[model samples]
Target chain A: MSDHQPSQKELPEAPSTAPTPAGISRRGFLKGAGITAAGTALLEGVQGFSREAVASTPKGVKEFGPEPFPVTLHINGKEHALQIEPRTTLADALRIQLNMTGTKVSCDRGVCSSCTVLLDRMPVNSCMTLAIDAVGHHVTTIEGISTDEQMHPLQAAFVRHDAMQCGFCTPGMVMSCVSLLEKNPHPTEADVRYAVSGNLCRCGTYPKVFAATLDAASQLARKA
Target chain B: MNSFTLADCSTVEAALSQLKDGAIVKAGGVDLLDRMKNGTDTPTRLVNIRNISTLRGIHSTPQGLTIGALTTLAEVADDPTIRTQYTLLADACGHAATPHIRNMATLGGNLLQQLQCWYYRSAEFQCLRKGKELCFAFSGLNQYHAIMDYGGCPSVAPSSGAVALLALDASVELTSAAKGKRIVTIRDFYLQPDANPHRFHVMAADELLTAIHIPKPAPGTRSAYQKYGEKESHDWAIADAGILLEMDSNLCRRAVVAMGAASPVVRRSHEAEAALTGKPITHETARAAGQASMTGAMPLSMNAYKVQLFPVAIYRTILLAAGQMDRDPSAAG
Candidate 1:
């Protein structure tokens, strides 16, 4: 896939919304409208979950809606009190709200680890973490790491090994590496490969990335 | 950063007192946000419950391991205690999504992640689960649908972690508005389509899955879990296998063989378990046990391949846990 965002010229024209095998009837339309209205209203208001409500509403309908919920998210050692929607993902919270854009948001889905971030000294896909759900969690984004003057050891190691190509994946890759070395200071080659199986590099920089992970681990191991 | 309201409750009673018809529990939000984004799941009130620290961490003792349902996949995977005892579950977490997803996705969230059915996800397709007349996945992309557990609604449960958890004899602690807190087995966590296809979990509307209690493995039991997908790694399992075996003087004293991505719940093989117990672990016995595991399977036209692949998984899992896959070269090689 191209690194460039989808340009309007590159985008396809809107397709016609034709009725398929089973078209929506008036009653069906009303029902769909009712559901949309209910969900939108809940997202707009962001209130009202009780045990009784849980008991009343059936499963499979996904009764959760968007709401302005207060959360105290700890990034690095700093605590941030922010109002977020129930549906707002930690990835969006970092990229959009906190303005920490180092953690890329290529795959909005949780499949790719482009949005990997540390939570309580472990790495996870920020895109999949619900901000409301992450209340009281210790979230460490790429920005939360490294001092103003000194770069983190992992970052320095990546630079030393020339591990990056386009550098789009550096932040998340380094974060995942940091998590791996933290748990296993001296990982075998297979261990390092398996640890980062979740992340992808479009430039196919696995060899260099693997070397950087090893180099960083060695450097950190010596310091420790 | 977007806006939303909060309804915090220590008990189900406080939440239900204010909740009428449209409230939803907000646990870790991994699945909740997807529902919100797709316009498929929405509740008038979003109940926040992660603050209840009591509902976190794994409780491991001689009898069993009691894991909070809200426990993160990373916690379940990395717990030195769990990695030592319940290696099956630890492997499941290590295999789920990627490192990042494992961090945010909770055991509860993984178990309750929305079905991967394309029809249900698309706003246009009104599948049977969503109150529609027919399910296009039946005729369309039926490759991933259930085989044995299909007679009723044909959706597959999306929990790879739950499968290993159940194989370890885990149970859940559910908090209800009316009934208070209660415990049930991980096997009881699911509801089959033959009973109610609309939902997968058996918990009541007012009930919340607060914790899970997993019994420790028997003295000599060793367990292993392997999830096979199209990709060698970093992908959802198209087929998954879990095995727990207790060895007594070179003879298999007890065995539990479970498979997921096969049904709405992890399918345990009683016949396979029976064949292995009180018998010496051998290549022939392992192969026979594998055959008996999927004996009564009725696969869909597309997913029938599972029936074939399932047996190999059964055999391999048995030999692997028995420490025979690497040691013995008698076809269990």
Candidate 2:
């Protein structure tokens, strides 16, 4: 292949520990080059370089391809191993890899809370979190919140109050509400609003969602 | 999203080493991931610094408050000391983003968040901040652009933490292998768009923001933050003010008033602070201070609404900080 050609070629196969013309090993070159090239390319547009020029671009840099790597995720109380690219978000890993579709992915840019899930018991946008980053963290999706036999109080209240319209944002809303209730058992209406502010229900289920969350909070308080 | 390698750094040293080796750092991954997906940023290797234990807590000392950079926004909003002693900071953090975002976004990440200008965030527009010759917001849809003229890029700084820190006079501790450690005041931390349109703050690529130092305020110091948005929740501020005042009886001894979203950088209105100092914070003085805060403000075609809203936000923050306003600022409007 021509050095300046921008063809989508596979990464050259070589020993991971074998050093290139530069002192750094092939693995080190791949790691460093992928990062440096991307970082610089973000500010300065990507440049066309020959293969030799790319290899000799820096001492410890080499380009990377879209290859999958082994990743172990601790979802709820279970551990699941999957092969995914670095671009795969925790939400995709849960929904696609593990088949835990309870966590939705609306506005995957972290604006909407449809992908909200508990990471170490704290509500986070699963779509914005990388699966590799959640390696050791405990992840709890809406499916984990309720067992096969019994539904969580928040889930039950969501159904009782008819909090959802199209039911698209229900899982995320439930996750956020449950997280809030866990932290503050007696949250005010304003608190509920603030807790789920990230979630957007196009069906205009605000009033119903707030009602269900308040009812669930009261029920949990009574149980305690 | 562009494919990248993940470098899980176990310690601060390890993270710094990766950074030195040209790896971009990821903490909460909230803004970074979004930017990556949008093609605004394409970091190939992300050095996960979330595991750096030393950068993860809020500590109070006799001198002041030391907040670790990795401390999540949720922790900052919920911490008792931050809530009571530095209500402005707490309120700013709480009002920023959403519950899920707050749980993930770290203080350091929040401070370095890029401008939220639609044109800038979008990949199609190669604005001045994106190394283009001209800014699209300069003539295109500019309803949400900066009102205050900072020259060059017109996007406003999108950090609520920066506004609060400016009001509180906080300093950030930046550490790098080459420079060791140094402190930069919040005022000096941010650069004007005219000076460096591409860069947001003065933080170097190899340096890490380890912590923020907020000096203990004088006795009887009261602070508050008030922002005006279209929605009551989950909306960026059209105009916002963070005020810190040292009250002696009814008169103000010292005042620091910082405004955000109205300007390209978190700006402290010295004129507004001067209007309130040594004077009783009555309705008339507060109103004057509000008007004074917008001195020399030059708004764009669509952002003139920010000029009107800035005064209201400033006035409301002053009233709340002085204990004159008892209700939430949002309710006041």
Tell me the tens digit of each residue's lDDT in model 2 across B15-91.
Answer: 67667545688888888887888998876667778878889999998889999999998899989998898999998
Clashing pairs in 2: A3-A50, A29-A62, A33-A61, A33-A62
Candidate 1 lDDT over residue span A1-224, tens digit each: 11233233322222435554588654345546755864575544534333344345433232333444456677666666665665567876765555555678776766668888887777877887776555666777777667666778878878888989987777888888888888889987767777777787788887888898888888888888
Candidates in order, TM-scores: namely 0.80, 0.87
When superposed on Cα atoms, how far off is each prediction in RMSD?
A: 9.9, 10.8
Tens digits of per-residue lDDT for model 2, A129-215: 888778778888887787656889998999999899999899999998898899889999988987888898889998999999999
Q: How many pairs collide in each candidate, listed in order? A: 26, 4
DockQ of each: 0.23, 0.25
iRMSD for every model: 7.9, 6.4
Task: State in Å the error of residue B257, model 2.
Answer: 0.8
Model 1 residue B114 lDDT? 75
TM-score of chain B of each: 0.89, 0.97
Q: Could you give candidate 2's fraction of true interface contacts?
A: 0.54
